[model samples]
Target: MTNKPTILIIYTGGTIGMIKDYSTNALKAFDFSQIVQKIPELQQLNCTIKSISFKEPIDSSNMNTSYYVAIAEMIENNYDTFDGFVVLTGSDTMSYIASALSFMLENLTKPIIFTGSQLPIGDLRTDAKENLITSIEIAAARKNGQPIICEVCLYFEYKLYRGNRTTKISAEHFEAFASMNYPPLAESGVHLNFNEHHLYVPKNYQKKLIVRKKLETNVVILKLFPGITQAVVASILSIKNLKGVVLETYGAGNAPNEQWFLTLLKNAIKKGIKIINVTQCSGGSVILGHYDTSVGLKEIGVIGGLDITTETAIAKLMYLLSENLSDDEFSSYFNKSMRGELTNR
Candidate 1:
């Protein structure tokens, strides 16, 4: 047995796990049990590495609440056995999956670094090796006998970002993800540089990790466009059993000041639907009531998303809805930061 920290690498499927068969030129999932042999560089970290993969690996596009719950349960069952965890998934929906995990795992006190690559591991110029190796190092990193990072985070193209603060910006570039509203928690280069101040320290290090598995799925995003009409807006509000809507509004949370639009949103709110105003822009905050257009939304009880990514807004809503909080309690919790998903006003 070694004294080095033991890191667990959980593979949920993606390009990073795919290997090419030279003969057929077809891609197939790599055997995670042989990962050490496949990526020999991982041995240099001086840590005990163990890996596990899904029974039947899936693409990131098929990611759903059930898979999110399964991954959380796996971590919950193994929380005490490993010092840290490195999760691998497809980059396409990494932000969404990672953001959901941030909320699902509460009172976290160890590193849970999420990483993926844009290209297959077997490719000649693949980025999979670097992303995988550094993620394990970050997970195993400790300072003064305590985990340096105590929250869920995404590491890609050398930058480590708060998972909930990130968004998928590019499909083809190696730098496929970005945390526009927040700064990097750590960066890998000539030497690993950690932005110490940006790291999240759990309020109660003594508290046990609480895994929240019940995530509501009755939420939808209503992205507003210039030519949108009353019929289109009304139809979405009528989604049966819909409990929440992530309103992708114009800059600074502005929306159409039209009477029909206001009436439809008001009716939805009156019918117990929670509507939150998030900005459509890739970067910036949603400042409700900042202008004439948004004042109407605020008055009608639309919670301001406040610099939160649309991916995170959906995850937080699913999480909060399961707690059975009252309308007032839900609004209060959403308007403020929980799991560092959004900036506080």
Candidate 2:
């Protein structure tokens, strides 16, 4: 006889787990274990679900490295017991959390689907039910008894996206997430249609999952604007113990060509600070040497961020900075895609 696949739901405090009070008209956290009773559609799924939540729910804006480590450890403790995992977090920082998890969990062979809703689960027209139910279905989906999705993913609005590639692009719409650089891994219509070619497959199925706990948070994002003053750049680079900078530049990674601008960045790089050139535009790769304005950046040892999103760039920078690699090694690793976070050149 075939046994049902077991899934673990890790709720890290988000709108999806909230319910309303008719008397006070206030919102409060609800019991996720009673989800099956509230939403009977979950009961129709063929898999068994077990839920665990944080002691005190937090807003996504308050998410930090400590929480990231806790979530990874939770999965590590139950990796062998559960067939898959569905993590629920606030949509505001869902992309950042998802991207961090993608890098933290190496050699992963089972699905880790991150999802959340724009509205409360108890709302009359809430999107939580669809997002939660579909995420579980995708996590439990299998072929020939092997899990079909073997990577970290974000499921929202009937579309499944690679966790590292997704970004929260909307707030008022049901479709709140988008993976502009990559295509949807799967879609929900009359039936679930999966793009198998885009799915990640582990080379060694017998290998165990590796969970990384040490992450450095001494990083800052420097966004360049038309009137970005030299004072602003100097203030950002002068931060104490700053190890990395995600430089959000103009189109195709072009930055100001002024001598002072170039000098500030050049001196920063000389002081062992890693600066990554990522595009400020929502969609496109950073071609450092393709334009006149960007040539100075290429000459100053600024690493091109390629098509990596700012959220993924931040997570990748933090993860790599903890390794304490050499300058050459850091640049080499950053250029290459470590978990499908960016397109390899």
Expressed as tens digits, the lDDT of each residue in 54-148 for candidate 1 is 99998999999999998998899999899899999999988999999999998899899999899898899999999999999999988888889
- The per-model lDDT (C-alpha) reads 0.93, 0.93
RMSD of 2: 1.1
TM-score of every prediction relative to native = 0.99, 0.98
Q: For model 2, how does the per-residue alpha-carbon lDDT over 1-345 read when each residue is reduced to its tens digit?
A: 137989999999988889999799999997987878888999899999899998888889999999999999999999999999999999999999999999999999999999999999999999999999999999999998889999999999999999999889998899999999999999998899999999898888789899988898999999888999999999999999999999999999999899999999999999999999999888989998999999999999999999999999999999999988999999999999889889997
Off by over 4 Å in 2: none
TM value for model 1: 0.99
Candidate 1 global lDDT: 0.93
- Candidate 2 global TM-score: 0.98
Model 1: weakest 10-residue lDDT segment is: 1-10
